[model samples]
Target: MEFKGKLSLWQRIVRAFESFDSWTAFSLNESGRRFGAAYARYAEAMDLFQVRGAKRVGVEILGEGLTLGVGGLLVMLALALPAFREVGGDDWLKKQDLAVTFLDRYGNEVGRRGIRHDDSVSLDEFPDHFLKAVLATEDRRFYEHFGIDVIGTMRAIAVNARASGVVQGGSSLTQQLAKNLFLSNERSLERKIKEAFLALWLEFHLTKSQILKLYLDRAYMGGGSFGAQAAAEFYFGKSIKDVSLSEAAMLAGLFKAPTKYAPHNNLPAARARAADVLSNMVDAGFLTEGQVYAARRNPATPVDRKRETSPDFYLDWAFNELKHLSDDGKLGGDRVLTVRTALDVSIQKQAETAVESMLRQYGDSYDAKQAATVVMDPDGGVRAMVGGRDYGASQFNRATDALRQPGSSFKPFVYTTALLTGKFKPTTIVTDAPLCIGDWCPNNYGRSYSGSMPLATALAKSINTIPVRLSIAIGDGNPKIGRARIIDICRLMGLTTPLVDTVSLPIGAAEVTVLDMTASYAVFANGGKKADPFAAVEVRNSRGDVIYRRDRDLPAPKQIINANVIADMNGMLVKVVEEGTGKKAAIPGVRVAGKTGTTNAYRDAWFVGFTGNLVAGVWFGNDDYQSTNKMTGGSLPAMTWHEMMAPAHQSVELKPIPGVPTTPGGKDAVASASGPKGFEVAASPQRPAVLNPRALDAIGGIDSMMKSIVTRRGPSAFLEPAAETNLFGAARSVGGRMALQ
Candidate 1:
């Protein structure tokens, strides 16, 4: 205006441009030259039109000013033609990207990432006043504008020119919707033109309400929240309908800069910004001064909710599964997937808490720096998993990724393999004496020996020598039983890790993951059915259509082992908890059957077990393979297992271990040796050939002890009378100087 008042019209334009910095002055001059050229072309076209009209009328018809005005209209129409072509395409009207949400087993939302659409609400669901507040804060003339606001654009340009940087955006709500939906956020002349064109397209195609809805649904709120309803829920912990005027103003203020004005991060700054929005609302006539004052008095503060545990481990596993199930195992861009997972969030939290607590409690004393736990159902649904003490500190999923040796936890499979061959029963006496197979010599912990004991007793105590001797006997050039037989059993039980056929294989030298181990234990829990542990149960799209759903009724689980073998395995494992190494893991009212494991030099301690309904596996050790301070499987690992499983079974029904005898104390009693419900163990026709004289002598002592115990107990509940081996010897005394393994 100053330049216009001081000089002639032409001189005023030139002087005003000359006063600008180089870039602004150059842009203004270039625009003027283009405008002049267009005007010249339009002038020529108008003159031709006038000549034709005058030729018809025999006189000049139209005035020069009117003709020039009509010619300018034609030039403007030509400039707008390209934008029409660009926005007329079908792709321009597609929906914005929807985020993925993860729900727990009971259909409660546990996590959300990507652009989650599960909680998106329609515009009709929001209060009218909230919508009014949004429009007032963002665009007061939204209903009257075509698409681009010329006055707003000019004001923004002037402000930016003065600042020498971008300080404001001239986008209306619809224009912002266009940019968010179809364009990248890049500052360039071409992109700006496209944004303007798309905004016009949106206004032409959608109603004002539709454009506002799109904007509200796609806007980013802080703390991984997107959309209006999610933002409200994230900040206020309530539905959009329940948001007060002040809360609505606060949410509206976040549109300008979510993190900058995020009340969760800086309350004072957010309140100040909200005050600006409230003032805007008052000025826009959407709110009265009194209303604005009332709103300003009660500002909404961001909710102080922090996630209990990082669900990254579970989500990462689910995402991999989702990708594998998608076309060609690839996830395309901007997908909206709802995964219904088998995770029990409560149990997961408990597991995480237990791991951290255990580490804190015993880490210094035991030199144990890392631990992992996995909980699963008998039907193969994973309930809870703690991959590490802190997922934020380390994202590596030790439960699913680390393949440490399971040690004695692997003994169950070895015992199951022996039992499945019909040659061994839980009570079948096995020698616990020290034995050397060629160059390999195995020793029990503390070099202890129970002389000769029942197969169940040796397993209960985790006597290392007996399992090795049994593996050697089963695999000793026998056509029926190979050294690798336990490997096949492990695979059937869901252990995917490879195993070696060494003599020590039965003592759990094979490396395996916690998930596989837990699933393997579930086989016994499910009564011999093979459990295929899974995470995702169903997946849905943005429109509430299920893209994938697991078929729960897949042909009955493959029967790997007989029900009798499972029963016998259950009985023996129960005894382990009752009277052996796993006694620390016993839940007083509920029956549990499991095994304890300790690796060489106490590098790894594992406790894997199962209740009637749930199976759990726990591991304790240093990540770098350093030995713990003599922490056996019965110590921290068992304690952590108890801590996790006790809470998990609180609401579960009390059930006895199938085929086991409950104690006179009730549901926890040892099984009758005759077995549950007249269950009979068939005697083997051919007995194992005792190759070593020491083994033969050891077996004779075991037979005599079994005979003595059976006599005293009037049919021992666990041990059965064994068909005596050929070699015989006097029975050794019961107690030994060394401690039991």
Candidate 2:
């Protein structure tokens, strides 16, 4: 002060200006000390001004300098204020909607098509290690920063400058949240400014924890996953809270680049990234060096993509049913829904395994590239379904889509029609001889016949001629019988496929879906009641409100066939499984009843059968309807049915078919003269074996043949002598004196 007292006011002002320059340089280096120095500079410059209006030259100069400095800062802030006000708020988050979820019958998640997730994890529910792992890998100075980290920014700038490109990002967690919530990923200076402003706004409006939750919930994980919970499940098949430290590290490493670090996509790169995250965890004190070493050895295994399989066959079918019931005309938009299906997941797995196994074992050998299976209850509730061997390879629901000929499987419906008319009985004899009608002729499976065997025997052998004759007798346009009566019966039994009015219709010449055929079979299984097969049972919306439920009582099933007719049908079908072509379909303790069907040229092989508890159908064939390698319905289709039904019925109690004789030690005999296994059953001595000659003539196209048979002694008038005879055929009641086996 003594040295400065002798100086002029102008000199003092010049010295003050030099001192301000020094303070400015110091302020640029140290932000904490800048405010004090700036205030001192201003006060010292003000002292140069006079108390009165007449000011000195030094005072005027100082006033001009202060005005320009302060005025320039004010102008900049004024321009920036509008940009800061443009930051988004909570309404930005509200624009995003949640995804839909699909649940199985037992309330377990089976599959999801959209951005699915569990309930949001609160700050208290989020594990500390998971949070630490995320922060340590993503941002270490999260809490210390107010929207932006200056030191981190400067370091990142230096590093990027040396690299000649963006090698590091200085964004804070709040900044990341802001970008994820509202901003686009355009890498421009303008976008960066908006990101910074939005980050500052978020930091001021929300707590640190809230910002973290937003990031976790909005981050897009790989494999169609949208949130942390979904990512945990999609990547490691575990919940967020249950994730181990090593697993947390691996998952946290995904935030930088989800698909690039997805273990399933690139395990080595994922591991490398995870190692860095683990090292960061150790540096952050979340884990010790030893712990990190151990974690490196046992990183999380990638989620098994196979285990998360969606039963697309069942789910797709269920969704179709759901679509019709939804109020908004779609599934899983904003409203979360729970679709309760009738599918038995365990049985469904067994069905899928059986189908795939059969395809692998015999697909190439049989020229059968695909297969479909369906298991359902008597009331038409689908228990299990496999629409194809590999749904990923082909999504066509063969079980419900492909309308191939049912072949001999359609014979049962024809038989049912005859039985319901009271003109035919299981024990009634039918001549299996060759018959031609208007350029059409039908034959047995092997072009061989059993002469005049009973109706049960003809069906057991799946004799083609008999069903054709029966359909002609019942379906022809006669005064007593209407035209295409068999088609009417099929429709009543739930066969939706169109059938032409042709003589070959009885031998399954028409096309029909597996679902329709399966439901038709359920009519006999349910004691003649027509059951419309259904997949979904009920549906509930996001708020747990019941949207729709299946009306099990609605549209009560009609008794299309009489109980006595069904009983006879069940008994005869049982013999088909017990001793006939469907023997491979038999279970040791369970009475099985089904039919074997091989379409013309072996294009389709099918075994449609049922136990006391369930009815299932199996179909194996080429998609183009090409011939197989001599694969018959009994070989592959019946075996596949057995493989699936055996496991499905394991927990079910064994019981006999509804009308089958279950008396222990009572022998059921078959008589076939054509081969070693002629499917001709002999009735007990107490039951009468009769044949209506008139009905036979009507179907056989042999006018006056039955009239001529009356003069014959043996009632085997329509029979043709067997070329070769089996021991059972020797005891035939038609003509031979064979003994009962």
Candidate 3:
């Protein structure tokens, strides 16, 4: 076993060193060193042995030399075959169509974004000190090397051997560029060989300027800037021609670690790296000592606040829309698919501007915090989305991904559920006092409530106990009835996360995402239909063939609530803006209706409302979930909603939620801009009658009758009948009998 191990090791070394036929390979072999002249003479002697071994091949003295050479060459070729095949894509690489989104200047969706990516330009246009800095530091011999530098390779090999590590980096800029653009991130002998072959080929086939241009175009700069031009814009908020040397150096130094040295991240680390680049420039003669000193002393100016991006929100909505199209479920496929999203530059600009204003005003205490916004055409087309303050800072996508307490905004769902299913209505009355499920107690934002307010009044004021009491009064005994009890309602509205059904869930406990809640509101906005909110309207391939069209009928908005109840709910929501907590969301001319939610921890604030034409949701919170600035939904989010919605309603009139029309895009679409001029509610076609509020409340906040049927806490686990009876028995015993009795 020991001898076999040694033999295997010797075989590997022999194959490695004797493989290539070049003198470079022969010089590396130890045994071949001793055989120098004899090895050459052995070739001549092979002719005499060849005749004797003609009948049957014989192992002659000369054959030994040829055998060794041939066997090693074959081994090397075997190892190199796969690498030599291609670096990145040969025929296969051409198949992939990258997923890139293009937005208008105001960051609104102009149309479908991204393609095969076939663009390159000149070196001078690719400004910023970084490229020059990279050229200086990485390869001074780049201009001189004819692709594969024999001397550089030799030096690298010597250093590698001495260091007992892969320390040598002799590949010229051409080689490195080839590896990056064409090769995988692999370090192997085979990779090195391929790099050499490709580099030489590139040198012969492409000009030096072409090579540099390609390198600059393909370079990855941090902060989502893909190329040098992009890097310059990201760092300086200006064109490449406008970048200074220090700024250029900062970007150039990022070739090592884009995220770590990104100007927005660690200014100190970025500066130190820039100094290193300046030093390298001095050594490379790109700059003199005086220039270097000047650059070092001059600090890079602050990169201007970039026009904000909304990749997270757009991607989220795209993914949401993708589910309808992707039967198999994957994106960024090889197909040249085009997605037509319903993003309006006008509304998106308003949403972002509002979010930015809030962040600028209140972000000091909410440092590193983020906010998200979503606006939908009552039909569920997501016209605008601002996921966070900075999409590049972190791609966590709080708008769509985050699941935080909806504060009081979730009350409408529970209230709406009661209105639609059986016996619940806005006119129902319930006390806003201490409420409990087993040992758990829930409270309002101020721990105060009106004694016996009507349901509409409670919701408008965002009083906590009304929704809880209403949820129990109607949904009691049926798990499907309570808001906290049923997550499928949330699911029906496009909510993907689990709604934790805790005791306080009636008051927006546990957590739900802004999207999930906003989508729920869409049901109310569109006359009780729950159209799945979507960013992509229609998707076409590069050839303009429709590949994926949003199925307006499939994930169709089922009648989740009654039209009359919806009308009543909207009437109350309007009061929320007109006379309640959402005052800041009130638009001057636009008749807006919505709800406000502020979590117990004050960690999240939300305002969701709708005009005649649109329904928008805005949320404000620290990305880390820490609370400061003491912001409430009524403050920042409502104000943002007001700011955005006010302008969005310009040139358009605010009408009631349009009724479902027969066609997808028809008069109903236009009708959304204004109310029916002369339509009489009594004469117009309408749905089921709202439940008698007095009769439903005969049970008094369904606390006892149905406590067992619904999920006990948040929106998760189901409650047993036995548990419900126990809970019900206590609440019923208050007056010597259950409230229902």
Candidate 4:
């Protein structure tokens, strides 16, 4: 205006661009200034205005500035046309809603949750007041103008030019709407050009009524809700058409700062904005004079509300499964998916609470910030799974992941193989003396030897020597009973990790995952049938059609071992509970059978077991994979297993180990044996095979005492009647130690 006071058209045009966001504004103004200065010099040289005076020269410069400014703007508009906003399509006009995911919460833990659609209101159902309030509060001249407001732009330019030599926006409703719907709200000439072009395109493509409708329906009201109908219900719990005057005005007030003025976030701000919009509605002739007075006196009300919760952890886990199930969670080429899982809310909650409590109890000692627990039925249907202590803290699922060595837990596989082959009985004696294989010389827990011990006793105590000897006995010529047996057993259990093919496997030298370990125990509980452990039960498509279903035929669980052999193995494992290392795992009333495993240096402590109905595995370890604070399999892991299984067994109808003597005629059927005493006798090879000769010719002090007890007590006193192997039958009362593998 100052330049226009005396300047010509070109000078005023130059001044017009004094306030702009882009470098183009500055560059254009500088060029105009230079041109003006050069023009003044040329004018002085020619004496074009013969009556040259200060006022005349100044007026001439102003005119020249305005002319150049107008022409320059037109040229820039043409050149920067491509950067202008393009009109959005009909579909885009419908509106886009912010996405929210739901989750399955069990106890204090969370599981997989899915997304659901709740947007019920559509475009045509909107009311007239919605448009009136929106226009008054958002774009006051929504129906009367093009996309860009030239006056608003000039006012904003004038204000900005006075401060810090910068220009800010004075965008009208149409221009602001255009920026939201199509162009980005960036302070650049490109963005401004786009906003202007799209504003014009929208004006031509959509009618005044249609534009107003979209602006009302698509405009952000507050919170995460999009569109007016959504905003109406989101703010006042009512439809747009049914909204009261105060409610409508309050909804409109959300335009300035939807979140800040949201009745839910700030009722005072919302009421102030509501009053302002009501006054604007009156000025626009849309509201009555009486309504304005009423609205001013009676403030608009905001609603009590809460944010929709997000299924952060559960959704993340579900997505991972979805990725593996369908093609990256899509079905039939559409990015929609549904999964049916066996996660009963009650059971899931119980499992999660139990697991979390265990973590809290041992959090300091275990130094374990992360843990995973899986509970499954005898048939392998996953009942519950707590993926971590806090899925929000870390997304890595240790339940399905974290494959660690089972240590002595892997011994059962070896013993089971030995039983399956019928080559080594529980009563068969193996050397418990010093053993060193290759560079590894494995020793018992205390480096003490039983000299010679039976298979049942070795397994009962979880002795390291018996597994090596048994593996040699079973997998030797067949190569399928020992080290190979471990690998084969893992393969049979559907494990993907390779196992140690050496003799060390029996003492748990192989790496196995907890899921596989639980499933392997499930096989024993389910009558030696290996069932698949799976979390997903079924999946559906968007059309409510079942795309895939789990085969519940149970497949008869592929008999992995003879029934009697399983029974015998079960019988021996029972002893593990009766007097061996697994006694701490005993559950009341319900018969439980399982193994205890502590790795070398006690780095990983594990207690995994199964009841007649459910199988659960609990592992306590540090993430750095370091030794724990004096933790062992018999400590926290066992306690966790008991804690984990107590609720699962409450209503479960329990069963016994398939081949064990839970009833008569079981394969493990045998005349009970007496406690071990002095039946084992050592004899010199040079002596006769007869008992008296071997017993009389005593080999040593311990041997002579064993011979006297066997001779005095009789063979039945120290012998297990069920033990079929009597390789030393001829020399029962021996003086020297018995020679056995």
- Model 1 CA lDDT for position 391: 81
* Tens digits of lDDT, candidate 2, 1-741: 455448889988999999999999887879857777999999999877536565566678888999998998887576556546555444566645335456655456776544555547776777777888889978889989998878888999999999999888888877877777776778877667777777888888888878888888777677667668878887887788788877887888888888898888888888888889989888888788987777789877877664356688887776666555554553334445776667777778777876777778778888889889889888898878888888878889999989898899888988988887778999999988888877878877777877898999889988888887786667553412432788888889998877777667888888988888888898888888888988656667777765565663257777778888999999899989887899877755567899999898999999999866789989999888889998888878888777767655543334555677553522232111111122211211221222222232233333233444446534553354441243124223333321110
Report the poorest 10 consecutive residues by lDDT, candidate 2: 670-679
lDDT of 3 by residue, 609-696 (tens): 8865788888888767887567788877887776676666554434655432222332222222221223111121111222222323
Error of 3 at 383 (Å): 1.9
TM-score list, all predictions: 0.56, 0.55, 0.56, 0.54
Ranking by lDDT: 1, 2, 3, 4
| lDDT scores in order | 0.76, 0.75, 0.67, 0.64
lDDT of 4: 0.64
What 10-residue stretch in candidate 4 is worst by lDDT? 679-688
Q: How many pairs collide in each candidate, listed in order?
A: 8, 4, 16, 30
RMSD score of candidate 1 (Å): 23.1
Tens digit of lDDT per residue, candidate 4, span 1-741? Answer: 343346789876777666444678779999999999999999898786564568878888999999999999998788546644254346556434223222221112232233222334554555566567777666665555676667767877888988856645476766667776776546797777676667776787777766665666556666656667767776777777788777778888776667788888888888887888888898888888796676678776656675443333334545555555554433344333456554444445555665676677666766655556677777786666666776657776666677777788778888877777767788888778776665766788878888777888888888887777666677574434456655776678556676757656678767777777887887777877877776455555556565655664225567876777777777777777667876666655556677888887777777777766678777777666777776767666666666556554443334566655443333233212121122111211121122221232333334445566568665664565532133244344442443311
Which residue runs of candidate 1 sit more than 4 Å off their true CA positions?
A: 1-216, 237-262, 265-300, 303-357, 388-398, 427-443, 447-454, 465-484, 497-505, 534-553, 588-590, 623-626, 643-653, 665-741
Global fold similarity of model 1 (TM-score): 0.56
Better structure of 1 and 2 per TM-score: 1
